[model samples]
Target: MLTALGLLPLALLGGWSLHAAGDYKEREQERWMLDLARALSSAADAELDGTVATLTTLGSTPALQNGDLPALYAAASTLARAQPDWLGVILTDDSGKILFRTMDSYGAPQTAAPADPDSLNQVLSTHQPVAGRIARGPRGRAAFPVRVPITDAKGKLYTLTAVILPDRMVRLIERQQVPTDAIIAIRDGARATVARSRDQKGRVADAPSKSLVELMRAGPEGIGTAVTTEGQQVATAYTTLSRYGWAVIVGRPTDKLRAAAFERMGVYGIGIALSLLGCFLLASLLANRIVRTIEALQQGAAALGSGAPLTLAPSSIIEIENIGKALEQAEHQRNAQERERAQLLDSLNRALASHQTALADAREAGRAKDEFLAVLGHELRNPLSPIVTSLDLMDFRDEPGNRRERGVMRRQVQHLRRLVDDLLDVSRITSGKLQIDATPVNLADVVRHAVTTSSGQQISMSTPAAVWVMGDGSRLTQVLNNLLSNAERFGSSATQVTLTVDATHARLVVSDNGIGMSEELMARVFEPFQQAPQSLARRTGGLGLGLAIVRKIVELHHGEVTVYSAGAGTGSRFEVTLPLSAAPAPEPCAIAAPHVEGLQLLLVDDNVDAAGAGAALLELLGHEVRVAHNAAEALDAVRQKMPQVAILDIGLPDMDGYALAAAIRHQAGDTPLRLVALTGYGQKEDITRAYEADFDLHLTKPATVADLQRATAPLT
Candidate 1:
């Protein structure tokens, strides 16, 4: 009786444990199958979303907006060629008349209408993209259409469709690598199989089993037993995509799952039988010893609870001995856990302190960097201002035999100024402070201005009358100059520039027969500081930031720039595409030039050289000029005789330019004096401050004769 009693609980425990293990394995398998179904559903959604995006982009193309069927066909053909799974691209009117198809030759008559007219109608009605049902494509294969609606400026609607092959979706299923006998399938909203992993020969575009359809109708996702189209019973897990009314079903054969469970149960049964037999035999022998051993174990447990050392002697039974050993180990683990927790707390404290310190250091470093850039710009421009003034002075003189020297000096000075501007622009770009002063700008005028200012090999140009785009004209000019400069530096003998316009976009292409880039250089060409390999001499001098700036500025204008090169020694081509804007009213004929010469002016700069050279340049320009080295001197001069204009430097030895300007305004209460801020600070904030301080104009250091003349011109 005692042996049986002891063996009974052991038998029950073995059975319970085996049942729990089986249940756990089954639950885990179900969870995995459900997860797989969700993953497959997500993949299908991504594919459909990608097709829709492509169609949307194509719908916005300039050729389509302008109703240029041939150009639209060509563009669509190029896109279709890039995607192997794309059967063709189609365009249709709101009434479903096929305008063009990439599968057909350009301008070829198309008799067949779009494969899915209902989806096209839906898109036209909703003004939203749609994923159409699988149907017989133009190629007489199973395909589906993704449609996006395009509306012209006059609100006329058109549809753009991309016919996609179903085989690509089957490829998506194959990539999941489901079990050999398992079934993975994607079904469209109409309960037809779009793609299947198994028995796909005649299964695609065919309806799934009635039972699976019933399960799909029950919910967006669920797990249940269903029969597949192949007449095989399966444990099916399914999920439906939210974006498109589609379903992804993963079905594992029920027979296989059952076989696995039964096999595990059989193994557990045999083990349990053997264990019961062994326990029956041992129970007889161990029952008598168990009571005494249990008493000793109880004592050890009490001692352990009291935090006292275990003092139990060795026992004949292995389990009793193990119990004593466990008690001792438990005491040791307690001490170790306390020590580990203390160390962990200390580590966390140190880490938190370090993080705070690093954050403060980072903020301080940023502040210091900003200060350094400002100071660097100030120091660099101070010297260039005097140089620019001297160059202007030379321009006024008709000195013989000095034209070449004068040209050399002027070019170098302009180059230095560009470098400074590029440096400052980079800072603004990184800090996200750069802004575009958008206005209707004519590309023809921009190209002309850039060509005249660019000093290099004569550039061949071809442009239409006027291609208007909303952007900053000066920034656009900078983009062109950078491209021209890049060509010149790379040894281009012949450079050609072409501007092509359409109703919605303008494309500017600059091609040069230069030292073309290698594949490695092209890969990272737009990254800042990326440059071609140079010798020690480094004849091509640049900071390698020109292309980087070009890309950023173009992006600001909602445009794109790309570079293409046919390997080294071949050539390189750069293309910039910007969205077109409606041309503004024709600018009024140029106003008569302002009489800027022979005026009374006051030039103030803390740098004596800058002030003196500026004064000399004004005097040479047939103007009465007075120079001041400080704000106090400027005020004194203004008090003595109120000049027509006062050009004050922001950085002064006395009160700063803003305060001095206020004082001067107070002194000349009624005098209409124009205050032009001529300083090295050229940031956006500095310009804003100039206006706020009542300054009529703001010009950075190194202002050219044209810039100075414009600033000194009477405000209109």
Candidate 2:
């Protein structure tokens, strides 16, 4: 082991050097492809620029201006043959009438113009060179129309059409020194190939490969690896021609790059293999010496292990001498080990006792806290029923003053309800009992509902169509309401709140120009009971659970919320992101609207005021209403006449609402009664219990008249 360790670093260094060499070669190959693409692009641009410039000078020739038609035709024909860049030249007047042509039957010059006279009109109108679409040029091959408009000494406009044949382009490409395996293609504005250095058989005007076309469409210039037309993987670079909207693509086969890399690896691999050979030689020599010493040590250890005498052949090595001495003191070491074992056992026992005590205390504290919250939530919500019912009674009276007071009262009740709901949610969440109903819901309607419940805030909404997400609509509305309310209180106004939805994400951004949070406050903004510092005038004392509850609810729906602030008094922005649903929320199955006439109904609640007020409200709605204050009373009333609907409160003097629901179901036997549960205990577990007891629906206490009406009217 020691000999191996001494030689290990040499092997590692060699391996690392080989890797570095291979990476360097790979980078060189990539850079080579990019450089080749740039060079070919520059060459193509120069060829086009050179041809256009030559034609512009020719367009100003004096032969054409002197009205010497024969002389001009001879000069143009000589120019086309001498330059090899122009397939032919057609001289056209401003009216697009072709008068002279230079190419005929077998690409030889001719006096008659071609039948098609369509290429000169654009240059005549714009007075600028326009790259015409690719077409069959004079040499019976694909060509580009390079048109230029010029005025002679008489100031009469004349258009000169110079067709650039692929033959000339082939000459330009031949001048470029590219690799044999590489492909360089130039495409005209219409994506038809002007020249391809490595073209396979047939088809002069074939379009470029799909990969090259896709890249050119996406961006001007970039490097990538894609399959070529021949299905070989290659590294490529592409750029659009600057003068015209053509594309130049350069590609090198990936196999070539790999071959270059492998060659580099071979060079480095030879050095590593030699170094490894030397390392193994050194290790073998050292291992032989170490093996002899180990054999002597092993024999001595066997004698000592068998309880024989601690005698052996002595060595000059100091390490072996120390081992021999330790073997002689083996009896003493055993006694010490036994003492340590006893002490370790004692220590472990004490630690175990302490851990058990702490765990027990922690569990007890949790139980007490949970019990306290449950009692507090129930007691607080019990008194709210009468207040909400009284507000409905004031609406019936219809006095202007009473309506104003009732509105104020309703707002306060909602505030109280939110407070109670927050406390219960926090407790339920920590205990892992909170479950959210996930269904596709439209975010716009949810935000609008939340806005209507607000008081002193300005809210402007911008929504694009319908953005849907999978979550409980009511809970999502609560999240929006919390954020909006906070902005109204601590922020400038609701107008700064903006909600937007993209293809796959919904964002709710609320900004405040009011007093902002400090860095320290922002750090714990989502911690329960964390409140910002407040002055007397700005004191809006809350339980500080709003943001905390918002975070928990959003997380349950697979979303997150982030808050940003510039510091205290500089304002802040809160943004929430949730996954978008593919389809809009499914609308509730429509039930035929219930008849306005009276129907049999039972109102059951332990609170006399709640039962009496609900019964009065039902009687006014043209229903034959029966009232009860307990489970026994409600069952007795139902026995007299089976009502069409039974509204049973979960909390009762004799038994809970679930037991009563079960009893009513059993007694009714074959008869169907629409059982609706109304209670202050509106936790998830309570709802589950109600359903288990055969209740068709569950509604929390202080439900609106509309809610009760919907419950009482059975769906037909």
Candidate 3:
């Protein structure tokens, strides 16, 4: 409302300015027309004065009574020639006859006696000057007349002269100021238009009838307003020519003023609309600033609640600036709180780190304990292998119909052998020695081989035929065999087992429909020496290292192993995913043989019994064998004999196997001898040490006769 109120004065002033300016221009136009009419009337007056002087001179001539009419006509022609402005000159006697005359340039007589002699007699009889506007008449009509009387020396009137007045006055009235759609009229006393700016049909309907007459009679100039025939308002002004009883009118349409007012109003409206729009925009911008500042504060609060970093509010005005300052103070407080929280977290992390280190150390010590047990198991199994082999031989010697006790002993010895092997594998894995002979292998073939070796009543192979992986083929086979054996032992001989292989991984899923483990037991099933239950122990009569070793081998292969079960009675699934290798190496290549023909060999053992037995075995395989009981003795023998092969034992009395190999190579002058490390401690770092000592082969104790023989084979 205030904005509208302010704009009202500006709108009115603009309209007034336009109206005043339009009126000034209208008045200027009217004055210009008046000046133009006065100029035309001045030109007409000069023309009329010259004609009257020429006519008066001709009328008072003495040639009027002379009998020589030709001489009198010549005298009149002379006078007409002297005043070129006259139409012609005429000389008349007191009788008002055309006694002498000079014709116009067109050869028409300027004055002729009227058809009514009384017309000329009346003019002469009055004996006064008679003048009016004149027009050429009909044939035999009196010539256009402006008559003057002639006087003799006695001061009495004798003759009358007539002259014609042209259409100059009417032409002057025609050239007046008038606007479009407006009429300018000059009327006589009878209200008939004597002169008009337009045709009669274009005159205004309410034009003043009496005002035009009064203008001619009572006033020199007057102005009036009226509505035109076109239904537009007009202003009419008239000025009288007092000498001729004539009036000149000037008129203009009022629409010019209306148009100017409308244009001014339009301009005002546009300006007002723009001003309001600007105000609205300013208001909106101010509101947005406040809202955005509030939004920033809200966002900051939300960030604080969600534990994200908070920022201060935006400030675009005084109120918002104050709010922003407050927010900044709060943000500073939050920062201090965050610093306190960070300190608390740091203290907790430090405590956790200390506990974690202690826990790690304890776990390492427990792993060492499991490794020691596994090594003890391997030591126990070495003696038991021969016992078990001998028992098998004894069982074979007895016939199937005889010796039932021998068969029982053979089966029991084999079970003991398996338990000892599992314990040894656990030891090897824990001690970080579990060496893998990686090979590019068709997992399908390995699965099939494991299935063939297992004694499961039902086994199903679902793996693709050509999915290849890199691993020790023999180790993978053992892993699968263990899983199958466990399934058969725990689930029942009637349980089915599955093996699957894909491009990226190989899965061995061994499920048992028979009594499965509870969740608690399944969780710990892969732990060494763990079993399902005390009651199932008899049904599955063995050490529980099978699944443990399976898990260990899969871990070594960088694979994952998981078990799933519904509960105790619903069965379980053990899934193993071993990554496929891009290229596989050879596998078990030396496991099947310990020698080739004519291969020179050396045997080193701290135990005399093992040394003699190993040398004898190498000789039996048709290779020359040298025996050394310690590292120093082996180095002496290499300096003397420079043997093509050296078998070094780690448990030597003087020096270990790896040290002995290094010494022998140094003394042998870099000769290309095949060195084999034969040690009971077959940890991964032990083999690496043997390689550093320039041994070509590393073999753990209980390496088969065939493996040792193959190690000594000639490189070519």
Best lDDT among the predictions, by candidate number:
1
Per residue, candidate 1 scores C-alpha lDDT tens digits across 1-716 of 66557666786787787778877877777788889989888888899888888887887888877877788788899999999999889888878888888887867877865676678888888888888887654345788788888876567788888888888889998887667887888887666788888777687788778898788777778888899877889989888854777888888887887787777778877877786688777876778688878897898889878878767877988888887888878867867997999999999999897997889999999778756654675678889999999888888885877989999998888888877777777777767887889999998899977877676786999998888999999999999999999999888989999999877999999999989999899889988678888889989888777898899999999999999999998879999999999889877799787665577898989888888888888888777999989988888898878988888898897789999889888998887888899988888999999999999899998888887887677644
- After superposing candidate 2, which stretches have Cα over 4 Å from the reference? 1-367, 535-539, 584-592
Cα misplacement distance, residue 72 of candidate 1 (Å): 99
Give candidate 3's whole-model lDDT. 0.64
Q: Please report, in order, the local distance difference test score of every candidate based on alpha carbons.
A: 0.84, 0.76, 0.64
Q: Between the candidate structures 2 and 3, which one is better when assessed by TM-score?
A: 2
lDDT string, candidate 3, 462-549, tens digits: 6565667777788888787777777767665455556665667777677777677888988899998888875833967888888889
How far off is residue 436 in model 3, in Å? Answer: 6.4
Task: Kindly state the number of residue pairs that clash in model 2.
Answer: 1
User: Residues 433-517, candidate 2, lDDT per residue (tens digit)?
Assistant: 7778998888877777676766687777666557788999988988888887777667565456567977789998877777888
Candidate 1 vs. true structure, TM-score: 0.48
| Pairwise lDDT winner, candidates 1 and 3 | 1
